[model samples]
Target chain A: MNGIHDMGGMHGFGPIVREADEPVFHHEWEGKALALARIALAGGLFNLDEFRHVMERMPPVQYLSISYYERWLEGAIALLAEKGVISADEFTARLTALAEAGS
Target chain B: MTADAHGDADVALRVRALESLLLEKGLVESPAIDEIIDLFENRLGPQNGARVVARAWSDPEFKARLLANATDAIVEMGYEAVQGEDMVVVENTPRVHNLVVCTLCSCFPWATLGLPPVWYKSAPYRSRAASDPRGVLLEFGTAVADEAEVRVWDSNAELRYMVLPERPAGTDAMGEDELLALVTRDSMIGVTRALAP
Candidate 1:
């Protein structure tokens, strides 16, 4: 799928923002997302090609709007649900629980 | 926080939930995840690529091998794994400068170079890197002379690329460690040349 996720050579995204002393991950969840992606691949849930494929399947608007790690998180969720490790209802229920808990 | 920021946080929350679910189902382990994160953050990174570049600078024979067989050469230096399995090192000469971008997705040589910087995965870098390599280089504050050429390599296939930046002119007296100090992650990605010593 030639989706918006393939942003290479497109244009108009603006100048790359350079921050002083940027850490590897801006937020703790970003780190966890990266780790989960790696571990999931390692555990034979999916190959790297599948990982990239899922990210490519993201809706164009959402792909453009989300941050990089957020995209990774989205990919992980899609992979997990597809693999049947977690159901769509379970994912929604968990998100609702997390929302109500205000975490 | 902005709505985008809040949405990002919510995504993170979902990730945490998924992680817990996986752990509970015995599909994955916490220690394994911790180890993977530690490998990326500490053990692997552009510093490893810097070392490879520095070694190539100091040894002509090693440079030949690196340019010829980047994956094996990189593994000789103890950096080899999934994403980096197919690696290619392009050299920067006075006449030609090299730039790398993955048009399909952010397919980087992560085993050696670690996680890519945010900008490398940004829409601007991806879009501009191939369409206007020179302009992108200018944004990176790297001036490619009018007489020179800019070659953009799209890591769109299984193969990934890293730039073996031209050694700075005044660095004849510098040791490998000193030279390594000047090889920024951007240089390897070909957004810029190696910094002058």
Candidate 2:
């Protein structure tokens, strides 16, 4: 359930719950997570400087849960797509995965 | 109900209330507070238990008894509930180290090991420690030997454990009290071990 820690970002994984035939986020907490993540990305609230603090002050669980990490991911993706940091196809795939995880 | 800011009355009042409530529900023949009161009256805090552990550190035969069956040995030493609860002690060895966690809330070996520490209750530690004992211990600053394989004990109704750490090296001549100083409460519950003093 907390397997997100092992990540270069795992694909097809964003659901909070794991059932035999269904991989889905817990309906209640996920929607909130996505909204928060989107806001952080669009607002430029997370940056490289803030990230070092994440590593220093937060344990693994808190590090990932912080609003800034998801926001940073979203911003990085947007910038990368605009500036050719990665191809558009790769960006779309990554964004879709992030959106799923943010669920 | 809101409790008094001072914790002193909190335990006492709660104990009284629980006894009365249990009695009303017919869970027991009597609402006797003395049963729990007796538990508190005995069972020295971690400091005293550590002293006993230190004695065992120096004494091979005693350590053997502790590893063999901790409950019997502890009762033989005159520590028990007025109505005692059974306790089982598990030893932490060189090849196979043990770490204990009350995954189902805070079921501890209170007879020998007294209480759980703060980190023990955190959802983060409990959820991760069982699956990742090595990582958690490293975070706790316990370095295990490369050859040592860690075993995490998830405590429940049927099985509970207390760790009997291997006596630290280089303290062969120390007296009982000095050895006990090395026996940390956390080590008994197996999150950490007593360090050599």
lDDT of 1 at A83: 80
Tens digit of per-residue lDDT, candidate 2, span B1-197: 11112132322232233323324445333313333333333444465467557756777898788778777777666656222445666777778788877643445665555544445534456566676677677766788888998888776534556777778888788888678778877787676777866
lDDT digits (tens) for residues A1-103 of candidate 1: 5677766657688887766556788888888888888788877888888888887887777777788887777787887788887887897887788778884
What fraction of the reference interface contacts is present in each model, in order? 0.72, 0.00
What are the per-residue Cα lDDT tens digits for candidate 2 across A1-103?
2333333223342222212322122222222222332233334444433432333333455434333223223333334344443445754454355446546
Clashes of each: 5, 3
Query: In model 2, which regions exceed 4 Å deviation?
Result: A1-103, B1-42, B81-84
Quick one: best lDDT, which candidate? Answer: 1
Per-residue CA lDDT of model 1 for B34-69, tens digit only, reads 887788778878999999999999999999999999
Give me the runs in candidate 1 sitting further than 4 Å from their true place. Answer: A99-103, B1-8
The lowest-lDDT stretch of 10 consecutive residues in candidate 2 chain B is B1-10
State every prediction's TM-score relative to the real structure: 0.93, 0.53
TM-score of chain B of each: 0.93, 0.74
